[model samples]
Target chain A: MGFKRKRNDKEGDDDAGEEVREVSHTVKKSHVLPSSIKNKDQRSAVYAKIKQEKKRDKIKKTRARDAAEKKALELGEELPPKKVPRTIENTRELDETVCKPDDEELFAGHDADEFSSIIKRDSIPKILITTCRFNSTRGPAFISELLSVIPNAHYFKRGTYDLKKIVEYANNKDFTSIVVVHTNRREPDALVIIALPEGPTAHFKLSKLVLRKDIKGHGNPTGHTPELILNNFTTRLGNRVGRMIHSLFPQNPNFKGRRVVTFHNQRDFIFFRHHRYIFEQKETKQSDTKGKKVKEAKDEKSTFKGKTIARLQECGPRFTLKLRSLQHGTFDTKGGEYEWVHKAEMDTSRRRFFL
Target chain B: MPRSSTVECGGCPPFRALSFDVLGLIKVIEARGGQQGNTPKIVERWGEPDASRCIVAVSINDRQNNPLVAVGRKNGEIELLSATNGDRRAAVIAEGGAIASMHLFKKEQSELSSRSCTLLTCTINGKAMLRSIEITNSSSDSNSTDDPSTTWNVCSAGTILCSSVDGNEKYALFGGKGVELNMWDLEKRDKNWSAKSPPKNNLDIFTPTWFTSAAFLDKDDHRKVVVGTNSHQVRLYDISAQRRPVISVDFRESPIKAVIGDLDGNTIYFGTGSGDLASVDMRTGKILGCFVGKCSGSIRSIVRHPEFPVIASCGLDGYLRVWDLKSRDLLSAVFLKQQLTNVVLDTNFSGEEPTSAAANSSPNDANAVMENQDEEDTLGPVKRKKSSKDNKQSKKHRKSKKKLEEEDDD
Candidate 1:
């Protein structure tokens, strides 16, 4: 049976070699075999030679083994046990150990007192917008649009600035945040927002982004900041409100208007809306023509009215901002937690005065 | 740890989903609709619990517009199961060793008016065997007569960790622990390259680096291969352009375990040993974002929905979670209660009916109100229906969890 199997295997090898030679003439003959056998006789001769070579190799191996065994017997020593094949357990220790970051290391270099003090100070945040070089062409339009809403924002062209240099420049200029827009296939996919001076870099995946002009406007800009800012948004709701508030601020501050509203975030939640308050007179009540006409006339009355009411209303586009990370001081690169607390359930009934 | 004994998203209806664990046990889950929570029900259970014969790799082929799941086992056995019914269709044995990876491709010949499906199974010892499954007739009853012809070639002499066939089924790529990336032409049945080592950097290192996972960029014309190394580096090689990698970027400190490219070929999603799944732009190497929640173990497999913007992933944590790629929000999470090694989504199974039903119904409906009241009663009946073998397994899982917690405390 063994001899027959060997003959079959030799035939298979010859067939495979012939197929390869037929398909590709560039294949070197030496690589397949010493030389190509032209006829059946030559092939049989080559197979006989191969068989003889294998027999010789087996004889040599057996002679060597027998000699070693005789020597061991002469020395009155038992032959060594057969070698064991290595298993997976043998290489199990090759796996590298992973280092996990702890809370103390993440919050290093910053004290509780300093963090609280920094949080308490309510200053106008200056933001610098940096676009990734690969998406520079579309970055300008996005920057200009973002500037229309954020008065303190400035655009930094790509290739002219490096991340380290820009961070240092922002630190020197006392910029509060640096927003980097990363594009995938020339489309804006994410925003990496880093809080300046001290660090808390947040990475947010952007989706469903719409320009301020695209979203229907309810009322014109008040041209005056609100006296009191109300922030009642939490979790994902707060994220949306934060994005909307980000778009409300103009690129260039309106000194003549002197009125601005800002939504600040704390601990992954929007804390409150801040604005300068301005008083306005209420409009006089007009006849309820639409309501009366709907009730009296057979035809349905349109819900439109000629008279308008002059009342204070929250103004701006609503946007959702996802908080990604919270870091400590500027230079502690690894000292930050990327995980944020997410609410298990959304409370739709929560008080949200500013939609 | 199990929390509250109730599933989240109570108002959502159940969808048909399947998950398998390291013990070779496959569980089919049906989502429930209720106000108390959307608890998943085990609709079916199959596969044996043998430690030595665990499943290592799995792939779902919907090429013929019908879903067929190919499961590879640790003992070098490949089993084909019907996606809709979980019935065993066929089985084949390859060279002895654990099956490392599997890919399904379809070969159609217009002249013969015949279509044949090919199953590529790569063993840990670096033998890639291609099995041709020929359907004799279109009728379901004739499926048993399907003949499977296998042809195998040695892609490498060492362990292979990952393997995949190109979109056109013309080329196949395989890489593993000690082997550099290698490509084989399916038509020629020969290696396309002679390079024995991967593209090297200027840093002098004597030892050869190993690849943990690899994927083709999905562009037939580009012929680019992206591989994630054990050294936390992602390298892209254009075979036609150069022998070395054209671009290489260090992703993170953790070893990447699985990788897949997006449809557009400009973005690549990778999962690491530390349970981080993120995407990076292929052109600029900028990380788009990371998907968060329910990822507590090293990710093993990630499959993106062909039509939807959702990606399903399974890992050692024994949970299969789906996430929206655009928003990076977890859409759903199912606890399969086993160390999951691989997962593949059945794209042909449209979950619209169940999902839409759950979405359309209001939480205040009378049916939901009644179901919430009797939620405990339903749980008792289901528990009683489970076989004694499954009951023992569940108890073992609980005991293991308790032991893990005790170790953590110590």
Candidate 2:
């Protein structure tokens, strides 16, 4: 009995100790979050991923809504119900092929020669990108892509009428020539590319190009009228480019003593003598005379007689581009009966493209 | 009746001999010799590397009945220190900015395990963070696990709450520009809900850069909020109305540092930055009385005792003054080298064995009692015979009671 009593006591003592330990252990484990949610880092990552996905979906919906509205407005349909703008809408559709490598074939073997050497000899080609601002991410993407395709060529993004940042990039001595893809009317936004040369010598040279007379309206005049301003800027830009090349190669070091010549077309194109390009004008296919050569052997005197009837009708001012001392013979597109303007009119013609 | 009972100060007999001085800073001077024992010097020092520039406001945490000081620093750092030992036990850093105001909720022993005790800290850059650190100790584990501190940014509406309290899941933050009071919750960490207060647009016409103070006035059947503005005005907000303030009162000539004094939920003491102290009836919005106190500088903090009718005030002048309501006289003044942004007395031991040597009224007072008690207790055997005579008187009374019972039966 004594032995049994002692054994019972020992058993009780062991049970008591185990109970205390178990109670404390249970309490310690109970306060913590469940095992499934223990890893906060993983949970937060998943939460952020979900949030990003939601934002993307919202943007897509907003874009679709905007596109539908734009289409409805074009069709003259009733507007959609009004609502606050929730997500940002993507307005511009990216056309990758519009500025891609179809021109690469023109410069296939030109990689062996330096860009300056080839460009001086009228061998290397240039690709022009029309842009209103350098801030757009798309503008950078377009330039980088075109540069990858066309080697030994300069990529010009139509700069705003301020030429500072653009002039810095183009005047780096590495570039062959920066072609501002601009129309010579309406103060072409592209002249900004030519206006802002950043170097100390560039400021002095550009001061001569500033319009001396202030126009009555928009007193801060780039030139005189919007059309004249564009034309004058283009002309001045051409002169500066010629001076830069002249200073670079004093006697046409690579071009066998050929001097840079400038020319303009009725389409408002300003190209140098050495810079040859494939001019592909996309025309409205309004007529079915698709395979005919439309060039007519009419001189300036004959053209004036042909437009005599229209002039008598007094429809509107017939704008024209005038050129002085043509250096090269001009070519026309093979098409039908379309009114054609001579490249000379690019400088002096008062006529403009109505559409 | 004995005028003062021989209250047990821990196992030792109660001795009244502590003296406190409040000049430029708080200095606790203890008597060298006492009947019980010599009391140790009590000093509580706070602040870190950037103590001078970083500290903006300080408040006493009298709820714990212990000397817990809440300090808000310029870098939005909050620290709760053990006032007895000057140990930085709990520290919190909010988003970087200058801390505008701070308050520490009293911890209840029954709910000690709960993460309900919160430090509401506000920054000048329009941010309010309610930080809670829950300390849990289990009987089974000798090793303790301190829960990681959680802080929630409470100001998303470009507004800061002057005073905020978290109870259970419901938390109320009151005061913003234009008298806009908001009561929100940690449970709804997404946003702050507008907790309605009276004359809702009181601040609409008047723009105040600072609100003096705020307190929860009525919580029984009706939840109410009280806010004091720099314009010497107090506004009471009823949560149920969801509209303008229930009542408003112009109670001070200067900004009031308001504090709730009683569990009865009626008494509130407002200490002004200009040395004006006012007590107001929360129910009626009437000024009960006002007094001028020792405030050589702007009063930065005011806190009432948790269990006693005692009020402690500290200011930029580097002095901490304690007031006894019964006498309306200065109880003690502690002189500190640095400005007293806050001052809190440790009353946790007020009910416990008073081991605090600083509690003696004067050094001589403490020495006299300690020596007397030591001598009396050591001669305990001699007193036993005297105590035995008192026991015999009790026996005599019992014998008489038996005789009286027998005579009544006859």
Candidate 3:
């Protein structure tokens, strides 16, 4: 009786195994069952063949889908919608080409216009001059000198080197340039200038720096606001013109004198030719009387000794500046060629250190 | 009475299971289980050589219950890969500008017999497209078959930097550098929604100018959108009531790179360019906590694990770190050796783990090993305990010698 019951149990187990296999086969398309009533080795071999067939079938289906997508694209037809749009606007109609420019070409000239605007010298840039507080002795004097030279410049005592905060401050105040004097020990070592709003910061090494006391200068600054200001001076010709105008200012101003000219240095390049009002007397040809021609003229001249006065007039030079290439930071011969206004060798004969 | 009965047994003998050491060890084991032991391992990495073409957007969807990860590149290329084995499933080129954002949604009820998935992609130039994917698997016949098809549609044409769809996929929001926050009703297919302007604050003279990222809160009934601005402000807007943000909070003092909210919508997590990841309680406007360690660059993406109390983040530093939310401990950090812009986790991904080439020799692993050595050197208690025993023995010997000397004198 035990043997008979064991046989029944074995049959029941076999039935359950068959049911599980059937269910797995039905659920997974990749799973395949051997059909031949043969040896286990032969059944396994058939299953392997089924697996390979399924893989090949999958590859074939994928290829077909790819081909169909390509064909639909070529025909310029909209592919079927994935989701039924609840609103008409959500349904995308493929009307434009999918192909786009390559990355290199896409980003190549993206900021071309913006760059042109940034480098364009449209007006006199407002400058913010600052000095590192660590070298207070030398930095303050240098910063003060710079502030006096540049009209729109203001002095900023840097407490910390937080670039973000400095930039934020500049942006709020609408400063167009930021010049920071970095000192080593007790001497100024480098001048760091950044074009404000955005930046292409330039660092210039300092050497042979002569303070105002070392150079022959106007006894006192005129403190005059020029009626006209020339900005972003470029080329040797502009330098000559700037130097000639700078020479017109008197070494010392009379207490009552209001007319003055200023030449400011920025980014190593000199931006110059600012001036105030100047008055001149009109010239009149000296009149000679016919009665003075003869010897008796001496006697007549004594009677006409009291002369007539000429008319006084106001006059000044009127010239407009045509902006060309904008000079970036201070003039440095060893810097990048693109940073300079003139890439070729400059005419050094025209260079003047006075301004 | 129960306590008195236990006292009758002579103050219950120490229960081994109730010991502090056993409980502490159990807690540590549980933590380990929740960390690297059970967290989804990065099975594969598809790295791009040029870091400039880093991934700009990522979308994960289950098509016919098969996980698919789609990544959009800076060069306007969209790559779809299988989440299981990282197999290349499909590649689509959407040309105009770099892909700015991507969203994947599964249709609730499809007329077609097969399940359908939809992909919505937006380019930086404001062009948006919707692609439909259908997976067909038929097992009725003796021969098994599988087929996949895709359809494309143009949704909007303009410039968009970031875009997101609501939970029900009903409304879409788009914002960027110059564009103001705009909402579109997906059902009506129009931008007729009225929005209220942000209230003016005397302290902030300049309006929030540039919006970097935005996300929809996960609340179904109350529709809210959170926007992160370049000015380091996170603003929460209630769509139904007003156009302006109801609450504006200043986050880390750097531009916010990414923003996401918890499932309950009460806690919001934000990452900044300064490599700070912090969470804030929305109800009281209080900063809950910060996740610290190993993030040295701008965090590009932060994704919370759906099942675990951990968050995975990748940033400009190129390290993918998982932080435990409760313990605030770094679980695992893997260095990809390339600047990574985005990461997506496959919540339902269950497959044979694919060996990662970088994971075996990652610098993060070496650093972790070094850290463990340093910790052992500084805090090892075994050496201290041994030294204390030696000192005790030395003291006893000295005391016995003194006593002997006294006895000799007596």
Candidate 4:
């Protein structure tokens, strides 16, 4: 070992002495790009060579680790712990509004929230869907798609009516919620969700819409209620928004329909997606199979009941919604007080998120 | 509460016997605290960090019940506690979704029982109820709404965002977005007057009318009221003059969230939705300069110490800030961790715990206030307790949320 170390040091000294362009004192000398090679073409060639060398070195290290792991397995030893890569999500700033599982106050609040009656199946959800009075483009088409997506939703044309009067009309008619799809120019640009009777109106900026016809191989949705899935709604505001959205759908979903709807929130943007899940049987990899797995795969290849593999088929009309403001009451835009308003100044830090 | 063992600002009880002077501590950091920055030394904070529910409504104790504060949480639970030491005495369950406002006032039923404290709470659902409290000789008090009380639905065209009782406690005013300012005569149990919308501007566009905050201009005259609108306008209304506001003044662009009048009646302090807190001369309809220090979030509540020359403001910024009223300097600031919906000053906090802290009693040296060192105890206040959480060390206390109807005494 001493002889190998002595020879490697002598080789390093000889290389540093020959490489005269840049003078540096880092422990490792191989990684530094030669500053003296000022020629653009030469520097590019040297950079490509270094990149290839680094790629090869990484592959070699992974191969060595795999070999060691195989040897350990053969000797019936413990495997190395998995290394977790650091990402922005994993290193998110601490948010005080995040909900805890056993928070009694939060649970109590949930019991009394506006959506509680509908979500608990005490009363059926009655949603009234409408477009702004002067909606253009695919507004009607979007409303039709939404009518099918949401259970027990009725289409109500705005028809040059004041929003307050509409809200009053809906209140008299016993509508649980009202969804106003606002279109600007030629596209749906905003959405207003107002919980009825007692309200907290949520305004959202709609963008990146993709109609079902736009998506290739999109499956047609069935009349059966779609199972709703909400993800990453952990903050207080997010929880309230989730509840408002949840109340729009029927509580009793027919699982036999295999239809699914998802609202996934990431970095304050909520992505809406619709899909149908199908259970598929796994195709056996006989070459890699060692025992019972091969036999089970072969036996139940045609059957779907015992299959664990699930596949999602996209059923479209997907869009992204970003919360613009949450008003304390119904759609009185001119005078309503906003519970939380998104302002240009609020986006001071990229890591700081309200929802 | 004794000095639990004072070790140079180590541990001070929430209320009285603060081991260290708060101003001295802030003076230590004043060099770094920055001028006009959040520099006030916080003497007391009510709740813990990360509590499930934040304080939505707070009413200062009446002078007779000095230092005993009535706090309403978002989940509709009101707890009566000691302002200085954080000792909870009783609790009440209010309903109709998040408490929108709470007012502590003196309800004089008859000439016999001169002054009885009444607590009125209004929820977002427009349910308003007034509960009168009684002090029993035996140390056990129970009240119920059945005997005789006031409970009514506001039935506002829009959601009721805020309601305020005059300093004289004779009337209550309510206003919100789409809801005009309506005054109710407490004695008559009827509407006294309602505001009229102003005529359309030169462009013939009717200006939006929404009252975010309103306050009585004088302690003796309930007719004169100062209102802050969501349109960023501050209007002074004199009921004796006309249904419309007498003096109209427009402040900064953001909607006004809180409005409070200084003792002078004409001088008003209003905090805007954009976290700008400034004073306005009501009589002249002139804009006074802004108070020093900036709040990161919208301002929700503002309180003036009746005895002290200080003002404390808190809001969505989650900070409790105390400012020198005269100098407009940020005397002290403390981040309470949870976004504060309302703040109330305990005027008689300078007195010991037994005397009770009075509201509206301003003192010069409010810096003597301190915090509760148990730190962990604040978590309990966040959760609604159905049973009266009688301080085990103290004698028997009032039952949770009992309304004492004057019938018992009559």
Q: Pick the TM-score winner.
A: 4
Q: Taking the tens digit of each residue's C-alpha lDDT, what string does model 2 give over B274-372?
A: 455667777887877764443334465675655455566665444455655544545554444343455444544322122233234343365644754
Q: Comparing candidate 1 with candidate 4, which one achieves the higher TM-score?
A: 4
- Evaluate candidate 1 and give its CAPRI docking class based on DockQ: incorrect
**For candidate 4, what is the DockQ-based docking class?**
incorrect
Local error of candidate 4 at B14, Å? 9.5
Report the candidate with higher TM-score, 2 versus 4: 4
Instruction: Single out the weakest 10-residue window by summed lDDT for candidate 4 chain B.
Output: B22-31
Q: What is the TM-score of each candidate against the true structure?
A: 0.44, 0.38, 0.44, 0.68
What local lDDT score does residue B403 receive in model 3, on the 0 to 100 scale?
A: 98
lDDT of 4 by residue, B20-102 (tens): 11111110111011112112233343343333344667676645453556767655567665554565555666756777788
| Candidate 1 residue-wise lDDT, B183-216, digit = tens | 8887778888633455344786543657788888
DockQ for candidate 4: 0.03
Q: Candidate 4 lDDT, tens digit per residue, A122-223? A: 999999998887876698888888988998999998999988998999999999999999999869999999999877898999999999999999999999
Q: How should the candidates be ordered by TM-score, best one leading? A: 4, 1, 3, 2
DockQ of all candidates, in order?
0.01, 0.00, 0.01, 0.03
Which sections of candidate 3 miss by over 4 Å?
A1-355, B1-43, B51-53, B62-64, B112-116, B133-159, B192-194, B350-410
Q: Score residue B314 of candidate 1 by CA lDDT.
A: 80
